[model samples]
Target: MPLLRNALTCSLLALVSHIATAAEAPAPVQSLRPLLTTLNERLNIGDLVALTKWDSGKPIQDSPREAQVIASARTLAGEHKLDPEDVAQLIAAQMEANKLVQYGLLAQWQAAGHAPDTPRPDLAKQIRPQLDELQNRLLRQYADVAPYRRDPNCPVWLAKARQGLTHDALHDLALTRATGELCIRAAGV
Candidate 1:
């Protein structure tokens, strides 16, 4: 019966290993937090954008650049088999949040006597590349949530989802904009 005992022991070890792996894996909520955090991080870029624009005397509201970004985002969505509108909405909200931060920072800088102590990052070279990486991540995040977005309980689920976040994170308008468009409730459902 030694062979039988060894087989059973190997089976138990395999089962334990699988269970441990599953336990260590992130929950669905954990998966979603990154998406929200990415939105927040995207908003973080606004300071750089604002600083660059301020030094160069560029306007905060660049309609043409925003339009181009939206168009490119939608195209990326199509390639990823996601809804373009969903992608566009998220991008638009993100842009809105970004501008909010930009405007706030610019106003603060204006009130101050000089530029920030740290030298500003270059918009095209340093900042846009950061945005590009975040965009790719955001697209992957969109894919992960596409199924849940259609669920009837999306609004409720989203509302519940916020409870998992910290107050400071929630205070960031990026989280608001990111999750708001995702929580679209069906009427008369």
Candidate 2:
């Protein structure tokens, strides 16, 4: 009886160990934080953009500029073996979230007679070029993590990943919504 009990205990321990290993190995979402950090950095450009647009009286939604960005993103995605259409959708989500921040701030500034708390950034020189560079970095980060797009738990993991980065309540909600949309594209959920 004692020998049989020892054998059973060993077998149960081995089974539990195997199960834990498998569970730990396949969680693809574990690698998503760096990618999410890149995204958080990208979205943060929106505040400076809003300030610039506020100073210049530029509208938040520039369809032509947006289209140009979309085209460029698709080309970049192709270079990284990411699906162009999916990449476009992802970029659109980011852009729309960016615009939401921009428009909201711009509206608030307008209401306050253009005296925004955020200092105006140079749109033509400093801001635009910085945004272009950040776009490239963001695209590269997306490519690195693109393989895990099929993970069913992507949305949940992504939400968890951005917890620290999403500082502003409104902007954080917009970022979450945008990322949720991207996850939907990835998993068709």
Task: Assess each prediction's global lDDT (C-alpha) against the native.
Answer: 0.77, 0.76
Candidate 2: tens digits of C-alpha lDDT, residues 27-85: 55556777677677767788888877766777788999889989998899877787889
Q: What are the per-residue Cα lDDT tens digits for candidate 1 across 1-189?
A: 999999999999999999999898755565566677677678777778888988898888989989989998998997788889889988888888788777767777889956686678989899999998898899888787776776677666666565535344423554565577886567776
Q: Which stretches of candidate 2 lie over 4 Å from their true place?
A: 1-30, 111-114, 184-189
Instruction: Mark the 10 consecutive residues where model 1 has the least summed lDDT.
Output: 164-173
Candidate with top TM-score is 2
